[model samples]
Target: MTTATMSKPSVGFEKLSMRGVTRSYAKAAAPALSHLDLELARGEFVALLGPSGCGKSTALACMAGLQPLTSGSIWRDDVRLDTLPPEKRGFGMVFQNYALFPHMSVQKNVEFGLSMRRVPKAQRHERALRALKMVQLEEHAGKLPSQLSGGQQQRVAIARALAIDPEIVLMDEPLSNLDAALRIEMRTEIKRLYQERGLTVLYVTHDQEEALSLATRLVVLRKGVLEQTGTPQEVYTNPASAYVAGFMGYRNLFPAKVENTGPGDDISVVAHGTVLHGTSRAASGTANGAAVSVAIRPEDLVVAGQSTGNSIKAMAEVVEYHGRELSVQARTGPDTVLHLKTNEPVVAGAVLHLGVVPDRVLVYPADDGEETVQPHV
Candidate 1:
């Protein structure tokens, strides 16, 4: 978790907004985006997070003018973006595929945007070189796309985006094509680049850890609608709904009945006759005496013989050794699987005791379960 912030770059962060943005293909009866509303500030990195067909990419396209909105408005600062074409938006974009011009050299590809805008040849070359240097790909300037590795091609794509000196950058899972190690490396690098350049980046991805680690803010979408928006910590630690909670790495969540205590009193539930007292991270206060989802983080649960606090006795069902930690899943019931993690080893099918952290539990109304608005992170 140790991270260092990069030096700030001098790019401006123009405001971006979508007021009731809606889009639909003629074949589909309903709009892809059902009156979606979201906004991003300058010098901020925001993630579009959700599952497939959730309109996460579509929302970005509407804002980029790659696709026309059926209704609503896309605005960059005070200017209405709906009337403008893609190029007129003056935005930098890095796609999932690292769309480089194969026939062109690295420097030429980076300079293409400037060239298309009729930027001075000398200035364009200067910008291109500076951008290449930023990515540590100056030597690759003479090379073509086919000559580079996937990571190298990606760096080229980033350089091309920066060459234009655009106020904003939009990316669609740009690092997804790389290996796991490279994805982690580039995620950190991209965050540093955004901070250093003071670039306002609206990135789309389904990686929760990526969004949590890199973004200053986040927008969750489901079926073309905004489920929630907040700081990564806020969204992850305190999701607004069950769908959001489930999307944000909440593995141990199931229906529970609040007993004894009245509405919103220190909530307590029974797991195998153990009175498990815990708090739900739901924004709306939990409704006692009703069936609510009890979600807790796997890390929040500790494994020991018989520990204090709310605890559960269960048979360990599965154990995965993920290098740094042991990922354990315990069978508490026929359908209930409680996850636990430890630095020490634990055998599968061994009867063990688990301690659940009270405050880490998440509660949501059972009815709020169907929406998929975890829109791109």
Candidate 2:
């Protein structure tokens, strides 16, 4: 959440658009990337987030022209990018492996793009130095790739990408190689660079926390399809589907039946004899007697001083200390287990009353009474 802010770009029209993009391999039964349509405004950091094999990388490859699409079109302003080669797309790409040339010095690696374009030697040298300085690696420009740490190597790769003064930067898990602390450092640096340079970026990563922290807009992908696209707050606070709810950190989801509905959005759902009252996160078509899945975050379910409306009796089965908060696994009924986060720890086997606010409850259409998004193996 320490991300720096950038002024919105002045240009109004869409800077990049991908329409009906699908990529299928010869031996595969299914497409790596299915039909997907996306638009990026002039200056926005958009994260393509999903699990592995969900086609985030394939989407990036299609956009970068590294992988051909089975059926789709890519556009930059008015030009069709699908017809052009990868180099002709004029996009700066930072790879996961920090694709630096082993034989070249950091300075030369960054200047490679300029040399490719036949830029003047003085201009290439000057621009490379500027890029290196932007990433705070100018002093290390003379060093070889093997001499630098993983974070520094990533900086060099970023500097190389930025040396061309690209309009958009495509990063594929650029910080995955670094340790946790260094990842955070590089994430802040990337955000800073985007803001300072006013560049549009499409960052691909499987880490939901990373996407939530860095992107201005998040494009959630599931099985090669676009599940949802919105600002971080919107997507996290108001997920459009059960799959999205699970992805957004909702851990306690269970099957329930809508028992009561009115002209207002308020409804009651019953799961394993536990009745929960809340505003529906479902569409207007949700009606009484309809089966639905109810979702609540572990942090939202709290121990109540007294039983309030929408309260349930649970027995603490296990408690874990998470520093600031205690993660309590409690059994609500014979078969229903709920996870709760509390400030104070509770002893195992203690009976506890838990409560949830009506506004905090989320309801969704269940796929056979369960969320379709499975936990990664």
Candidate 3:
């Protein structure tokens, strides 16, 4: 079914803002969410990304009214939304699990919310069918959730959320239950829905790649604190901190001391008794002798040919075939390991010279309190 024919939800809003949103559990040392200030403009797709227990899910729950905030407020334009009940918030939520009734047919599951609101039978049925059609699940409307494949069940869950005609869709790891292939397919489907319907989405997930692929903007969290907010490209290419760099797939992190500050955010650092040059991500560039963490992604670390720019001489420890490229883990120091991808066939124990461009190496202050010298697998 074409999106043009599908029913549009009344989701337009100037902004939905979360101001100083904080949630805490009893006996917990820290709040699940801490002074999180976030905003969603009309039709914005924002992904809440972090590791487990980082409170990405908690943030979504607080916004959805499933969890009451310990402090702060939620606003939908001029209206204060935190005081309202979940049903009155006009937000639809898709869960990590399908969350469908085993005994109910797909159509019935989709119509449940409308029925609770006392919509007339015929109108609710029509809306249910339209929502099902939006997810391309109209043909399975009569089948029970138990009789469907995992992907089909997830589609039904999505249809159920849409049937409510919500002002915003709150999804908490909606595709985590599916297989890798299904997750990719559903990611595309969700992206299409957001674009075609101009959806206001607040999605939560721990997978950086999933968030990067689907979100227009990303909100990264660490230990329940909002770490950074930016476009996917901004967060991926230039992470704000060492913690963010680690999460964004910087497999190699080195403890370095600033050697000299060069022109235009370029600086040299002494890491493992070797001088390496990189771009400083810190707002105020590092000074000489200041401790810092240097981060580089595996793909950015290439086999050195001749130029001698930021080159590291290492012995390959492990080599894994990845079809088009090889994944190599190499040891550069007594306790330092670096991971890199290369097209060249590298044998274990082979000596290799790996180099990285200055722009690709990100430098963050070690005092960020999250620096790790070890390679991240």
Residue by residue across 11-56, what tens digits does model 3's lDDT show?
A: 4578999999999999999899999999999888999987788899
In model 2, how many backbone clashes occur? Answer: 0
Clashes of each: 14, 0, 0
- Write candidate 1's Cα lDDT for 1-377 as tens digits: 12233234454445788999989889986678999988888888999988777888898888778898889998877889899999888889988788899999999999999898899999898889888876668889999999999888988898798788777889988887777886777787787777666788899988888888899998988778898999999998888877787689876666777653435635676545577787654455555577766777778888877756778888888999889999998897787778778876789878888887677765566655464333232
lDDT of candidate 2 over 62-113, digit per residue (tens): 9999898899899998999999999998888998788789999999999999
Model 2 RMSD in angstroms: 3.5
lDDT to native, each model:
0.79, 0.84, 0.86
Point out where model 3 deviates above 4 Å: 1-4, 133-140, 146-152, 367-377
Please give the RMSD to the true structure for each candidate, in Å: 3.6, 3.5, 2.6
TM-score of 2: 0.88
For model 3, name the residue pairs that clash. none
The most accurate candidate by lDDT is 3
Clashing pairs in 2: none
Candidates sorted on lDDT, descending: 3, 2, 1
**lDDT for position 193 in model 1:** 72
Candidate 1 TM-score to native: 0.88
